[model samples]
Target: MLDAAEQYSREAFPSAKEFLRRLYDFEIYHRKTAPWNPVCVTGLPGGGKTSIFVAATRLLEDDTVNAGAGHVLPLLGFRHLTIEDERSELGILRRTCWAFNRQWSGTTSSAHEKTRLKEDDGFPMRDLKRARDTTALVGFRSGCCGVMVDEMQYMTQSTTANTLVTKSLLELSYLRFPFFFAANFNLVAKLLARPPQDRDRLLSNPVVVLPDTVATEISETAWKNYIRECKRVAGGVLDFDVDKDAESLVRYTFGLRRKFVIIIKSAYGRAREAGRFAAGMSDIEEAYKSTAYYTHRKDVESLIAMETSGKKEQKEFVCPIEVDSTEAMARHRMAQEEQGRAVAEQMVIDSLSPAGRLAYQQAGGPKPDAGEKSKGSGRVKTPVSSSSLLAGSDQFHRKRK
Candidate 1:
């Protein structure tokens, strides 16, 4: 049996840090209320993606049976899934609706048939409207329903899924359950770049993205799309050691990585307002850790890099390519990161010189001396930690044991 919210503690989502605090409040409130709001946390791979549902299941199960003061029967029931699973997005919907109604939360036949059914039912989550079924999803969801579509890229582009499920999600606001769609880059890119017709479904929805905006990067609003705004948020944090050029770094490192980059890259003010920085290895790592692509970024990056770099290449490749001998493509990325890092460091340090640090404290920002410890606060972290990154890459560094 799944445990309750209280039963599941912070360790369940190690990478999420204070973020779990946000989930716990949202989950608890949704359990005892109406109009369930499902949150979609999108990010790059290795971003700690599945932790939400782990917490959700525990929250839901607790609401079902816990005797604690905070527990209550959830107005919503849920089913979680990743895209790699066989069922298409729509198929998963059908199964979820079936489970919600049965109150069993276990697998059932694919047909979604239950003896308790009358022949003319329909499913609103799937928007199933066949005249042959009696237990349609419309009635069940009229009160409570929700589905967290994890690893959403597996969501097929087929008409049944893309069109129907998309429509179903749009119409879901009428019901209590609001869908939360989270995934790595490939999946997010498909959704963001969905054709004009398909993209309309998500035009005005709320989003929270971390900084890495490649095809698989989640766009959940870690960095607003305005550089001026980012500058406002950046404040003194901008002065830090940069590995690449800030402008090019923002443009290329995670191409299309953050959905609102053009806007946020406009300024370097993050250090003052939000205390979150987004232009270097540290900022990028923090943004990534906070997005939905936790388990998906590395895969997508490798795939794209391999696809693009592998084509028309006759030369041998090496891991941990030395900075000086690296190819132009690789050099471009490093340069961008370095520039951004340098610029950010400059800004930060400039803010901290004997006189500037005092002004920073007056501005409501962390004092310059406090900068060293913020790494643990999710302000930003180094992505290419030369010392630790190659931990699992030993297989490729073979010398024939």
Candidate 2:
């Protein structure tokens, strides 16, 4: 079960199928047209942007799956490069050249060879431009499909790198190379902040990937389907009632698929440790409360805060893209109001005498009766410390009476 859970967590599920189909269509359209505008895939971290990239690469490289394989042949070769330590223009150009050469030659070139190639005057970019155009006409003639770049946020780490990467992208665009890059919220914000021309060149065909919000029936159905699939993949290891625990699970994970997988794995581990064959709601809660989930929980809280408040504080996670969060924000506000009411009710219960407290518990604990009213006071007493809690305390006190 543990091994299965680990493998399941690592597998990339298609959380954005519609967007993926559109992206495939976009690629096919561009391939027929010759020169294609660059496309940017942007989303919050863990929102499945990388999954789309993987799918796109598969579409281009796997003839069996490529829809356009019959007429528009997929690129003879494609490069999927992830940016990490290559933070300069020369470094990126050299790496690209090395990757292209390695793929085309079908041989592992040594680091010494790479250094030698880098030292040649106007070596990499010049060679790349010439080869790029020539490959389309000569030999097998399929030519190189544009590169897929991931972790693009690294490009914005320094001003020099950012300018160089932008220039490189513009050059590729000028060449009509159809490139795709995946970026997170931070990178998207930076791109939008650039001058109009630069932004247009890079983000002309932007696609935003988002997590399941569970705000509408359609979203709810999708969320449940995802849970059902996860349960199926777990192979009987998860035994919780999806209908009963779906809302709680969403509340805990904030609809992020990655966190959902983590919680599932953690819950399974907890269940196994407790001598159980399958996990349940208690196990889920235990996993959620475990130390391993602290960072994820904090991230979810930050996301909610950013969405509800519409403020991009240094401590909060914010997306510059305009997202339709009306229903989600309403639910969040309602939950906050309920929490405030609970706290106020607890305060009222604490102030009661022993007999009153016992009677209150006998009458159904903290949940006050709706019809009852406080004698003489006419209205419920509110805690002075929390003015926000005052309005919600009326019903609780009335029920208590």
Best by TM-score: 2
Question: What local lDDT score does residue 211 receive in model 2, on the 0 to 100 scale?
Answer: 66
My TM-score estimates for the predictions, one after another, are 0.34, 0.62
**Per-residue lDDT tens digits of candidate 2, residues 1-401?**
12322232233112334323534464342344444467787776777776665555454342312334343433334456666655554455555555554433222234655576567554435465554433322211233445566766767777565566776666445434456777777777767778998887788888766666555577678889989988998899998877676777877787788899998899989999999989987777777777888898888767755655556774215556665567556546745654577679888886987678769867746433335454443766755666566755977899899
Residue-level error in angstroms, candidate 2, position 131: 6.3
Worst 10 residues of 1 by lDDT: 314-323
Q: What C-alpha lDDT, on a 0 to 100 scale, does residue 195 get in candidate 1?
A: 73
Residue 106, candidate 2: C-alpha displacement in angstroms: 16
Predict model 1's lDDT versus the native.
0.41
Report the backbone clash tally of model 1.
89
